[model samples]
Target: MERMDGVPPEGEGLKGGTHRRTDGQVGQWRGVFSPGGGLQPLLPPPGPPQPLPYFVRRSRLHNLPVYPRLRKSNRRLTELRHVEGDIWALERELRAFLGGRGGKEPEVQVNEVTGSLRFKGRWEGELREWLLQRGF
Candidate 1:
């Protein structure tokens, strides 16, 4: 039988490969070369940064607030969120007024879901006007 050398043949295993041993213990490959057998770059060099879109650039330059969800909503971005908040405040005020905290006595119960005030009494002159002005 013929004898072969310990060195691997070309293209058969790691190219330019070398190993170290400590106390006859052969250490694994710790070099940075790619194991794929090629010297190609791991990643292509990054390209120049892209420019922002017109609206995005403008908003950023002006420090404008962005409302992403408002575009899909029924309201415009220019509209404030205070409409519902105003309604809620009016409901609280009406509840207080109905509970005799507003120096007026009226038989009325504010609906929770619809926020409508139902008058159980026939005295509807002043209370009706107040509720109507508050959009209830």
Candidate 2:
């Protein structure tokens, strides 16, 4: 690279590479010059992952339904992982409350595309209790 004598022309750096313009445009070489005139790499070093917000962390700890990504990946229609106690015990409870099945059976109609469930009739017994507890 040629040594520059004075202020370089726009987009022209001392290293013969182009710098990004203040108007948000990049020049031909796709490199920026440092204060000492060496080319500075475009990307910065990677850092650690950021912590979840306080509410999100609290929700996860309390076994509450938080963001979809924080929940189990293969959750079924009647399967909720947030209840207290062992997972198997909770699964048994949910299965019993949902009337012995995973998918919406006779009473509830589920839209396959949107995953929305509609109860054709009134919900009763443990099902009603569970839904109410979960604020549904």
Candidate 3:
């Protein structure tokens, strides 16, 4: 087990040792040469690149007083700051309750001199369950 000139001397035709040189002759010794000698196939060096699992959606706005704040410089927007009263009539009743909940109608952006409302995408748990069923 000490012959390494061109490999292939283990069990005559060494099958499982993987030194691979099954005796067909002509410049045998299969993989692991490379310094510009060519052969290379041993693998296992690639690593890094796997981040996509997001999930997060569980805040039905409890004990509400109208909080709603997720705008980190626009992560698709969802603000609602301070907002005392009549912010454009709560943005026209939140666009008529999201246009009667059927689809398309989610861009409400009435600032009214900084009263704030901005909701474009992630409507904070359906706008805090429509302002806690209009009792906010």
Clashing pairs in 2: none
lDDT of 2 by residue, 87-111 (tens): 3443344446666545463344334
Write candidate 3's Cα lDDT for 58-87 as tens digits: 223223433445557745767765565556
List the candidate 3 regions with Cα displacement exceeding 4 Å. Answer: 1-74, 78-85, 101-113, 120-136
**lDDT winner:** 3
Candidate 2 deviant stretches above 4 angstroms? 1-84, 100-131, 134-136
Specify the highest-TM-score model's number: 1
- Model 1 over residues 22-48: C-alpha lDDT tens digits? 466544431123355533222322564
Off by over 4 Å in 1: 1-88, 95-104, 131-136
Q: What would you estimate as the lDDT of candidate 1? A: 0.35
Supply the TM-score for candidate 3.
0.20
Model 3, global lDDT: 0.54
TM-scores of the candidates are 0.23, 0.22, 0.20
CA-only RMSD, every prediction: 26.9, 18.6, 21.8
